[model samples]
Target: MEAFPRAILIDLDDTLVDDSSNVDACWDDACAAVAPRLRGVGVDRLRAAIDRRASWYWSDPKRHRTGRLDLRAVRRHILELAFAELGIDDSGLARDLAEMYRQLREERAQMFPGVIDTLDRLRAQGVRLGMMTNGAADAQRAKIERFGLAAYFDHIIIEGEFGAGKPDRRVFEALLSAFDVAPGDAWAIGDHLEFDVLAPMRLGLHGIWVDVRNAGLDGRPGRPHRVVSAFTEIVETPV
Candidate 1:
């Protein structure tokens, strides 16, 4: 809290952008639309099944790495598995559900409040800024462009383009080196504790966790150097 770091590496989703906040609502909308056609499977049941499969799918680091690149396919696969669990054999319906969720999710995507102002302030203060996000190149780039975020970052690294993502110390090392800042003089901020916090902290960068949901660490491994509830907190006038 003494002074801003010389450089900061930020995450895109849930940290700068409000991407994950509407997930449950979007899933509800998608499930409700297809519930009637799912034999006796109600909306709640279908949603639960899909949620379970999705959790399991992403729980594995290997699948999470591969699945994040092709999220549409991941959704479709989750829907298919859910349908199968409920005795439904319609791949077309599963695809439809996946598409619906995608559309609904995109419709509601927006950056978190004060993100642009915070980034602008940091930049104005001569702080080097960068963004490191994981996902397909095109998909990640689209979000960057859509949110007009490209102007704020000096370096933008997408996992698909970078050949790897967070939890990989190489990514953090490369970005800090790009900014010509020592790890201890830079900060890495993101929502994922392991990827954004632990990984960077291990390499000597100050790791700041954005707890958007106000979710406590809940005994998660590796405490962040700083924990904040919003992006704007990063630039709040030091007390």
Candidate 2:
């Protein structure tokens, strides 16, 4: 995408939304909540189990399409699995702890600094806008609605609803088709190098990495067309 691109697809979560503090807090709370019930189980051990389960869950893209893609469900599964492994049988406690984390996560989402202005400016320029998120439909929709994002995005695609996640060309194609824009006339901005940038790049859409915290891009063959530290930087130049 170049010279006033026609469309921009954005990733939710850590990209456009700031949820970092909540992530840590959620884990801390979950560990604490589950520890007392499980007796000898340490918070560190439960956290490690969550991290391990999260890695496994996200790596397999197919798992995202299933209705089981509810993030709370994933955490609940992690808690349940960990409890079972430790020979503790209290499904109620595990479910409650996981639900607690999910609520904290939903309550903490906010736009990254300058993200709203950037999006507004892009929309004012007549650039078609859309959201592509890898989450359950209801979970992702809550964040979108909580932030009043419905007016900004012309289309929204949640992997759980759409049956495909990022790094998949189909997601890009669907957005392109919806906007009636050619690939060269559109761009994608995301915090994720591989999923947000590389995936769109593969389909001929300009991919810009929005690494607000200066996170280094990982080694990947599908290079981003542009790299930016903040949304303000992207809008300053208008793509």
Candidate 3:
């Protein structure tokens, strides 16, 4: 029943937005954009290979931290792998596909249910809001503008712009500094346990896992301080 935190930092992908649709659209667009350059190579095979490699590298923390699996890097590496296997050599085509996919991703972002309304209510309650995402500025900013979700936040921090990704305390620290709030005075909410919950919790912030699917990531030992099913639950719950 105590209102301990005055500000909230929210994650963009899969937390406030339905990013799965955006990702799917990007994949489709990437395949089509690269298909002509594939030159008789099986598009399905190439896409499957890229998906496998992307998932493998993305889920591995060691590979991610070692600079082997960041977003742009992963896209380029996957294209290289696919082209190498198909005996193709066209870096220009790969670059074009990457850029196309990036644009498509921003265009396809769909805000999650209750996102705008909940944010509006939170702002009305005088809660300081901030955004923390891990992607290039153009894509993230585009999504915010497309969805008209930018004005609710006091600060927006993207890892790509900051030269570091989350689960790192420095990213969260920057957000806290921008909000002029102490760690304990703010709450970090995101869908990802490692990046969104654990990272901020390590910095003594009140991390809240937004488990929309009810997967119970918070039930694990040493996770976020709290977990909720949706953003609306934050205001309703006893703080």
lDDT, model 2: 0.79
Model 3, span 78-178: residue lDDT tens: 77776776677888877787778766776676777778888988887788998988876776777788888889888888776777778778888988898
Q: What are the lDDT scores of the predictions, listed in order?
A: 0.89, 0.79, 0.78
| lDDT at 234, model 3 | 77
lDDT of 1 by residue, 131-214 (tens): 999999988899899999999999998999999999888889889989989999999999988898889999999988988899
* Ranking of predictions according to TM-score: 1, 2, 3
Model 2 alpha-carbon miss at residue 143, Å: 1.2
Angstrom error at residue 5, model 2: 0.6
Instruction: Give the TM-score (vs. native) of candidate 1.
Output: 0.96
User: Model 3 Cα displacement at 234 (Å)?
Assistant: 2.3
Clashing pairs in 2: none
lDDT of 3 at 55: 81
Question: What is the TM-score of each predicted model, taking all chains together?
Answer: 0.96, 0.87, 0.78
Among these predicted structures, which one has the highest lDDT? 1
- Could you tell me which residue pairs clash in candidate 1? none
